[model samples]
Target: MGKPISGSAADNSDVSFGLTLMAIAVLIAPLIDIFSKLAIATIPSGQITAIRFTLQVLFILPVVALRGALFDLTWKKTALHALRGVLLVATMLSFITTLKVMEVADAIAIFFVEPIILTILGSIFLKETIGWRRYTACGVGFFGAMLVVQPSMQEVGLIALLPIVSAFTLAVFLLVTRLVAQSEDPWSMQFHAGIWGALFSAALLYFGEGTGSDVFDPVVPDALSLVYVLGVGVAATISGVLGVYAYRAAPASVLAPLQYLEIVSATLFGWLVFNDLPDALKWLGISIIITSGLYIIWREHRLNKTAGTAPVSPAI
Candidate 1:
């Protein structure tokens, strides 16, 4: 209704801070893949998933307590949180399993499809208006993912498809998160998700034990394995916290595209740590995925602007 304040000075600070934090979160996020890749050499991917959640709870517990919201949850919120936890397990298990054989950058590139999947699901479940353009972007994005998957599947067999599963599961997790996020404290939401994830994953590890399954069988962590698993938890905790605060500081449209930076981080880490690199075709696929994803973000921002609304920041 009124003229907006000038953004050339004061308004830039919060947005700038948010961008910086998001960049840091992006840069560090691949460390989770690095650790999972390392630890999965000896430990099962499911085991790594379990350790990550357990460590996340430990890492986040004090913060939740300090915020005086550790006990602030209702049955409904708890149930939703539990659902988030299950989806998180599915997401992480799929991701870590892929990390067992796939390059971190390639795996991350495929996972970028999550945003596109989210757009589709939002149209379906939220009954949000969607135009054909966004739908086209989603289709193109999947084509890019197929490019990445083509070579990966040839090299790694069906293991390459796991990131798609991860993406879909995470998309569902974010949907569940959307249901209760406005009514819950962010820290408590994270803490409760961690609690439920730890419980469910551990239970899975229990039931899946001794089935002779590489994905589900228990492998007790040795001393060095302990460090690797802790690394997974620590990286996840730090990136998660930074992301929460980043959204608090800036709008989703401004910060969403920056998430692609994780691919860069993952590629670099994969090279430095594991000597993995994407081939020329894989590079092309990665570029397409990033470009298509950015187009979707820009399209949504434009639509939200035309409608006089803000883009909803995702909590996943």
Candidate 2:
């Protein structure tokens, strides 16, 4: 008979599978930006955010039912899910708003600061230790994000700051996600979050529609626009599921750097769909941001190796 797999071997296998899932998530995530960009050509960002989450709830409900996970819900868990959903709505609203006025690649490049933000938040809120090297890398990553934002600021004005806000909210979202991840299945969490996000966005749409705020105004979508909205929903659902499971199976440090892959996908999609390309300076900033993020991941891995310790939760 073949020998049983060792515990460490099983763990390694899970990590490999998780990383594979993360890569898939990263690849598909850019589609949300692409579809949102297309949809918002006519649809308002608030409406788009509402439809995306409503569809996510519809898409994931059956999966949660099939998994027999609905009974796992508690008031506390439900409330936590709602709070996470609010943060996610903020993250999406900010990002999609940026996409409305900026190139997809540039907006995404600025949002890639999430990892750096995550590092700092992890150290503060999660009480994780960070050495000077990782701290310095975070600063470098922020500079790179600034580089991506500078040239476009003249045209987009304050809209360029939206992605930075997105990064901050996303970092907080992931931190909360880590806290609840162990108790809730990914499907259930996704379902509850979708419901809460849809409701929150609908409220925003209701309150802001006639308020002369262009970002919050509602617009009716034509048939083709409906297709774009549904595409954003589907892409977001897939990305959320994959991301939740990826973080569950692997350390955040292992998966955080891989998040950079989305920028490449975003750049490609932007060029193909919108004829948008980053300038040389923007490219330089992107390269630096990518480098800094990867260096932090590498430093964490080395430290963990030396200390013989596993990484902390939610690597971002």
Candidate 3:
């Protein structure tokens, strides 16, 4: 047998740095979200979302202009994009509301149900076959999610449903993302989402204020807090870009469990930044979520291997 080959220095470096980038990006999400809550404390969730989308639009304007098809929306793609845009805005606003009210770790843990929902939807819509093992994994994951949220007894409230709504909306957004993947470029998708989000947020603001068209009001923000909001926007953008790169670099099986690392990061951020600690039940719940997610990924890889099929997307 030939001697085992060592990876080249560049290959090793690339792998190392790529993994680092993915991990850090996952961790950054909760931190950015915490800042979003601070921003939302002053501005309405609608306005916060509007500003975030506005910044994204401004940041991407030069590229969109160069691309030329910026506003060209094909009717079918426009409809799909609009649907996705509404889901995106709903997910953001609901999630922000959850963050404002709930513990960060709890919210993060509850949101872990997303992949489970996606798996079910994939089976239903994409005609993707899932084995009994994967189904069991999904079930276990959902149970763990409940443990994290611990919805039993009096803990359940009207607002408690927000995380579930956020997850469902986000799953729809992800489904649309899969559908639009072949047609939409990242910039165009972002542009569509931004414009739609801005429009919807403006409408919400108008309705909430009981006014006509004047939606946005520029108020002098508390200095440090304004800086924090900007920081959140920047961090979210960076994390979002990193997620795209991570998906490109690895299979979803490889990347999916790495996403569970966010729980660790969120736990730390919650404790240190917000003094929010996970309770025993919540911890137990998160453990379930982590195990289920890791198992689903492993089961997925095993299925692909046995069937001689390649992964659809790299781990994200």
Candidate 4:
């Protein structure tokens, strides 16, 4: 949400400060889920997703206007963005469903499998080369995912599969993001993402109504629900912006590891808010996923170092 820092010492200080701020921003995500769950007590999931992105688009309108990035969209990039928008909406809806049904920690741990999915897709679609070390990293990351998901457990619900699917969808979104980033300005890409995501979700809200389905509870929207919706919008926006800034400020190697913090934070939040403590198997799964994620990062670092090239794109 703040301006990205530049070359001055003071700016470097600001960058350091922003790193901490980004971690706090990451925490806001789980808090958003906490709020959304509370809101879902009175609002439908479709309506909530729609409202979340509606407010996000509204929030971005002024910036898109001020920067004059509104007209930057062209037909060439339109299709790609539209595809990404569809995937993004799917991830949002599915992740929210998982958030409603599972502990935030478990959901996020499963979602951390994104890097593995992304790397695999990279080699297949993007033709990015993969090495043994990176393959090993992928293995470790999936192991960690298993630790969190613990599919074999008696209490584990089949619905938990949604988060893994959501993670794969998100990985596709990231792959598209990387492809688009080379040709499109970040603001323009973000603008398209927000606008299209909102439109897609809005259509779902419309159809839900058409089917005589309940959309909103018609209860008086209290301050808490309003706060949660507003927070979801604002927090999501902050994460997007700060994520861009973090990449600019430091190498992906430095910032990529910081993402693991989200898992720890979510685990803590899950325990504190939902009393969803992880058993030994879940703990093992979480450990495996985290290790795999880090291993991928490390493998990327090693490859880049040996090849004498810069770091690879950091996947979310």
Candidate 5:
């Protein structure tokens, strides 16, 4: 063999920086959840979701201009971005609505089914292969989600289904992100996604006018509630952008498991901010969901290792 490669040092550095970005992004991500949960107390979840994407667009517009990529999008990319925005809007609307009734930790726990959905979808749509063990884990993961949702169903009726919907939509959103990330830069992704999200949500708001639907009803929040709304937007912008760059910098298998840290931070914030804690049953369910998800991630890593493939990480 030739001399061992020294240039691998640069690759290691990139992965290190990527992992750091992922950690910071994951830890701070729950701030979005917290802020949305707080904001929706006075604002409709739909309006709150709209404001997030709107502010993300406003916040990132300057950066995109500074990078000279503000006009880089092709029409096809524009359509893809719009689809991503719609799926993401659906994800946020569903999850935040769940927060209107469910505890942050619990809602997030149920939302943890996303990884399983993503894996199964990847197998079906991307033609990625899945073994029986991973399939079994996915089944167990869904069962665990039901364990958490069963109680919420009793307490809040069908409202608990929203998180499952959130999980499915988010999985699809991730699939799109994976596809788009191959060609589009992460900042452009954010900018276009925000534009589409803002447009779609505004359309919903307009159509919701006079419908008397609680979820769609717009509200002029008080000063404090307005602060919460702003917090939601800012926190989302930060997490969303960081997450995009983090994925851009690293392989998916290495970065995927870091997301579990979000649940940990979310639990802490939920307890500290809202004094909400998962009961034993919810905790058991959260554990199972996490374990199953991690196993799936590990299997992905092994397959990638065997094939010497580096999978792309998805954006926010």
Candidate 6:
């Protein structure tokens, strides 16, 4: 209520605060996979996906209502949101399926290919220019993903491809989200997407019932399973909101590199929760992937700084 902070002072404060939030978000992000992996033991991936989205909608709708943003959707915007949500559902379903058979760290390491894919897709669809160095980094990142995939393929068979599939789908989802991200608040955007995601996953579950598919068969959660399901929803909601706020407060270039911290959390949780640890070769791959990803983020930061372009929030 006194004087408001302004100028470079305010900017530095905001960046510092945003980074703190993003670090927390990165720490919390691994829990979603952990809970999903736990839930998948008892619940089918489809049902878990539906429950996750349903809980997100329930958690977000109240915020949207309070903000009076629920009635502002145009048809084009609604369709875009729906498309993004569908893509997200595909990504989650694939990821969770992989979680069923793979160690969480391995699955997450493979999925880390997303930033590379997002960069390529940005060049193709958004017409963003990428320098040769950044392109090389992307190539190296893919190689690192392959390193993780090779061992996982031997261990988990064809299921090793699921996280890669999820990465691609997630890249596309980010591309579409970029197109429609305008003046809408992040909470509102997430709320609408959650609604569509819940609907889409619900339909999939309905049609997929009795197929005897491990990924598609729906199961009624018992008391314990319900806790895991709720954990998934709660973790997702918190991390997602934190991500949005973090991006809003700082440049995506600054925040993007920090996201690699999730791999550390994934590794720790994998070891602690499931007693699963990546082998030396897999760890080497993870290091390479993290290096390439960090290089890409560094390059982006340099380019943005040199070009003096305003920072855009990345769709995580």
Q: In terms of lDDT, which candidate is strongest?
A: 1
For each candidate, what TM-score against the reference? 0.93, 0.89, 0.84, 0.85, 0.92, 0.94
Give the candidate order by descending TM-score: 6, 1, 5, 2, 4, 3
lDDT of 6: 0.83
lDDT of 3 at 76: 88
lDDT of 4 by residue, 1-316 (tens): 9886556877667668656655655655566666566666666666777777787677777787898888787787888888877887787777676666677777777877877887888889978889887887787777677666665334557767877788788778877877788877777777777778778888887666646444422234677878877777776776666666666665556566667777777778778877887778887887887777777777777777311111111111
Deviation (Å) of 257 in candidate 2: 2.3
| lDDT tens digits by residue: candidate 2, 1-316 | 9999999999999999988998888878888889999998898888988988888878877888999996688888988999988998898888888888999999888887787898899899988899999899999999999999999898789899999998898888878977887788877877887888889999999999888776788877899999999888888767877877887798866777677888888889899999999999999999998898888878878877211111111111
Scanning candidate 2 in windows of ten residues, the lowest lDDT window is: 307-316
Could you tell me how far off, in angstroms, the CA of residue 124 lies in candidate 3 after the best superposition?
A: 1.0
**In model 5, what are the clashing residue pairs, if there are any?**
none
Q: Write the per-residue lDDT of candidate 6 for residues 247-268, one digit (tens) a residue.
A: 7898777677778788888889
Model 6, which residues run further than 4 Å from truth?
A: 1-6, 305-316
TM-score of 1: 0.93
C-alpha-based local distance difference test score of model 4: 0.69
Which 10-residue window of candidate 3 scores lowest in summed lDDT? 307-316
Candidate 5 per-residue C-alpha lDDT over 134-154 given as tens digits, one digit per residue, 9 for 90 to 100: 999999999999989998899
Error of 4 at 73 (Å): 1.0
lDDT of 3 by residue, 192-249 (tens): 7777776777677666664422224434468776776676667767776677666556
As a TM-score, model 5 comes out at 0.92
> All candidates' lDDT scores?
0.84, 0.82, 0.69, 0.69, 0.81, 0.83
What does candidate 1's lDDT look like per residue over 1-316, in tens digits? 9777776655688889988988898888889889888999999988888888888888888888999999998888878999999988888889889888889999999988998888888889988788999899899999999999999999999989999998998888887877887788988988898888889989988999999889889977799988998888888877888898888888888888888888888899999999999999999999999898888889889877311111111222
